[model samples]
Target: MVNENLATQVSRILSKHRLKINDRTLKRFLTALESINDVLTPELIEILVLDNLTIGESYFFRDRKVYNFLRKILPSKSDWTVLSIGCSRGEEVYSFSMVAKEVGANFEITGLDVSPQRIEEAKVGCYKFWSVRFLDENELESFFNKVGDKFCVKSDYRTNVTFTAGNFLSTSFDKKFDIIFARRVLLYVENEGLAIKKMYDLLQDEGLLVLGLGEYFPQVLEIFEPIAECPCVYRKIQRKEIATTAYKNVSEIRKTADFTAKPRAENANVKDESKKLKAQKEVITKTLERELNLEPALRVVEHCLENKKLIEAENFLRKLVHNFPTHYLVWKYLGILEMEKGNVRIAKEYLKKAAFLNHLDDEIWQLLRLTKGNG
Candidate 1:
């Protein structure tokens, strides 16, 4: 029963936070909003709606490969500044603190999320069983102290971590960070391009931008390049070098131009040229189709995986591999799928192929080692 007025209000509220949801979900939320007490103020309604919509699903060390890579590359001598965008309940920021301590690196990490309740919970530094489910006995004992039935973060780990509840797109920072961990965050943003540009601006020259696995966007390449060892990690391009590179590219293009070439012979040669153009057009069309299909196909595979439809996910992944043989993601997911199915040896092979495609992909290497251990 959502009318135009309610829809407009919902749109305005979501825009204030730069968030987006499918139309069905929006309508559901509006319907729920209508049933609420009429005595509530507009501000209270906004807060309640946003809190319900906020996604705070996270656990400690959710992606081990990402943290392991961070530990491997972080220099001990430098004082690092890290930012965790969409850091649900602060696990990620604290994980970085633990890594910094292990590597003897001086660091300060900031965790930013849009949910005030989440921020308050994060500041408390207490977690329930589900949040710490992945931690081993040693890690749990070292990082947390059991209080009653809950585990609380040790003071040592909490010293340099700060949590703030603010929308990333609207919040301003006085300083740029050396690393920004924004995994799975941009997917929720309505204006993803603008969000990316904001991250680019807030990142120092050569700063790291860490994303969730399989999260790819074409616009990111304009300002960042994927690190050799981590396909999900990108390094910001230096501003001055961009100008120089553009000038060099323009010069090279001018030098390579052959605009002064004489006209070709007629008839057969013209037909031959037309045939060549048609062949080239076919190639371009195929390539374009693959490019367009890649994201949707991956989403379907992810949906299958989430639903534990391993066989179906594998079928789609196999097709993706056949179509995009050189794509590292195809091989990576194939390896992951095989591992999920308990085919350790087959997983190893797929991971090895992925490593060959992106030799520096740390996650691939990590998965390969994991396969070896499981085998």
Candidate 2:
């Protein structure tokens, strides 16, 4: 059952944030609201509800194919401006940073999300082990530093990366971007046309727009053309002129790669079979890791917290802390859980432990300060 007054209030709040909530999500939102303690302020309730609605699961180098495509097409240019839409916890943004560094491109990236809490987490630039499961030892060493079982993005990667909390449709930027990554975001947007218009306006002429697999916008094909050898990637089509030498190369590559007719078949069945076996092996390994990893347990705790199931969230956090003693996030969340329960002393103690583990976390320190005031 849904409370009509509360449902209307939630709708009003979401509308003010430029977010459209459908009936299904609104129902779930109301159910989560039922677990809220009356001690919470209206502002805290708003942040909690909005944050839950915007939460997403993500990790670095999520799609290997997309990163490989980006590697090939990233022009050798200076001062490239990139925007990552719905950059949940900053993994994608840092992944792009590593790509730009490898390609020797001078680039700055901005990550935007509707959740202020997620934006704060992105600024921290620390991640759990599961987030870097795809990276090998060498890649880890190159891009991150280990701090008490947590991996922090290196100083080089963090230098030019910035994060903002706002709705993209309502937010205005002073400058346009060369590349925009809006993967799987349109699926949730209520007005697809308005969202597309916002993206179109924010992108420079002939800029790149990268989308997730299976996402398509045929109506806007006149403004954006799919690039060759790149899946789900489109280029803004305004002027019919090549902007740079690298872009000219892209055009040339597309022209030469199209042979309209089949070429002579080569007898390489054995080699192809071996490649298929290797790919299968990789998929199986990823599956096994997904099941065996503790990251999913953390996500479960997050889900519990989002639903305001404090006791359930606390139980999971305790188990996680026992198994992963050095994982500061577990401690941090425990602190937050206590704070939400109005136990300022316990919250401060838990937060102190978290802060000691990762001294660089500004959010933890801020939380500690808040707990002190509450105490």
Candidate number with greatest TM-score = 1
lDDT of 2: 0.74
> Model 1, 84: alpha-carbon shift in Å?
1.2
TM-score of each candidate structure, all chains considered together: 0.66, 0.63
Which 10-residue window in model 1 sums to the lowest lDDT? 247-256
Question: Compared with the true structure, what per-residue lDDT tens digits does model 2 show for residues 246-292?
Answer: 12222333443354442323113323333443443344345444433
Clashing pairs in 1: 229-360
TM-score of predicted structure 1: 0.66
Candidate 1 residue-wise lDDT, 29-144, digit = tens: 77887776475566776776667776677778766667888888887348888999999799888888988888888998999988888899999989886577556567888989
